[model samples]
Target: MMLAGYLVAVLAGLFAVVAIYAMLSSLPNAPDYFSVVGVSPIAALLVPPLGMFIYFLTIVLTGMQTLVFALIAEFFSLRNALLHMMFGAIAAVAGFALIWPGASENPERWADMGIIGTAGVVAGLVYWLIAGRDAGFRRPLFERA
Candidate 1:
């Protein structure tokens, strides 16, 4: 259960963060795409390529953060939504910092970071919804399944 939950939680976080990042990054009026039938499909079409690119970057940049946080949670038995959210935001921001080679040249660097951090929070919430709430629970070895 723990392994399954962990995998689902991580995947959920990854997808949420990437989807949100893609939506906000590519869409001019992102909110309109949320419900309008005409544009929603178009926006959906944009996600896959961007998602793959961002997914790879996220895995490379934030992988350590994710692993460290998961380890900390496992050892400390952390199940707090806030902690997960914090971890997600930190990981995302850290990833952004790690990836941007010319941060000084980019005028909108902070804006991108803000978007990513917000998405990370949402992702963390999604993770918590699926798995984080029961973090670090260990059944007794002798207990019957």
Candidate 2:
């Protein structure tokens, strides 16, 4: 059950990242694929055929950070909402760093990073709600066995 919960938490965070990325990227001046050329933003989200690639790619990229944070949280038995949020933000920033090397050095890239970080924050909150509340609960016996 713990493993299942952890998986769910990670999945929730990844989805949150994809969602925020889609929403923010749909704004004016974003990439052509994200922009609503002949369709409404709502419609674009509803029919995210192109965005599917981005969604999967983000999950693959950010999954590592999420797993790392999960290990730390589990090891420390952390359940604080703020800490989880921070973890989320940090994971998102790490993913952004990987995707856009040197983008952080530029002022314009800061905005995009900010968006990713924001997504991570929300994802963290979601994770806390799901599994952080009972982090490492009653698991010592399993280790012994």
Candidate 3:
């Protein structure tokens, strides 16, 4: 599972980087580094498609990450990895929500970035409630030395 996670993350990150590079190269009259940081209507127009593309890619990556992490935790016979992955996913979603508040508030928005946090929470909670016990819910037999 760890191997799977590693592979998926590397692949997805690589693809995202390539897409970003392509988008940057295709821009007309690209701004200087500092200028890129400032908000402009024109810039927003240029960014939406790329942002949507990246966000979709990120969602895929998160799904892959969650699956790989869960598999790893199961293979290692440890329950904590599930929690870690769940919380990590939630954090990622929250970060996106903060960055795209309008999307977060509006379900019909294009990217639906705002609901990521909520989805993460629901997924994690549901998984925990349903399959957590089988994945090592029992108390430890003895304290580690």
Best by lDDT: 2
Top-TM-score structure, candidate number:
2
- Please write out the lDDT profile of model 2 over residues 1-145, one tens digit for every residue: 3345445555565556556666767678776543332244355477787556555676677788888888888888887989988998898889889989998688878867876788788878777887787786455545432
- For model 1 the TM-score comes to 0.63
User: For every model shown, what is its TM-score relative to the native structure?
Assistant: 0.63, 0.68, 0.32
RMSD of each: 6.0, 5.9, 13.1
Where model 3 places Cα greater than 4 Å from the true spot, the runs are 1-62, 80-114, 136-145
lDDT tens string, model 3, 1-145?
3334333443343333334434544467643431333323245369888656654555554655456556655665565535744654454465455556676557554333323443454445445444433454345688678
Q: Relative to the unseen true structure, what is the C-alpha lDDT of residue 46 in candidate 2, on a scale of 0 to 100?
A: 79
lDDT of 1: 0.66
Ranking of predictions according to TM-score: 2, 1, 3
- List model 1 lDDT by residue over 22-119, tens digit each: 56646675544333433443554678776466446666787788778867876777889999888878777777788786754687676667766776
RMSD of 2: 5.9
Q: Lowest summed-lDDT stretch of 10 residues in model 2?
A: 33-42
lDDT of every predicted structure (CA atoms): 0.66, 0.72, 0.48
| Rank list by lDDT | 2, 1, 3
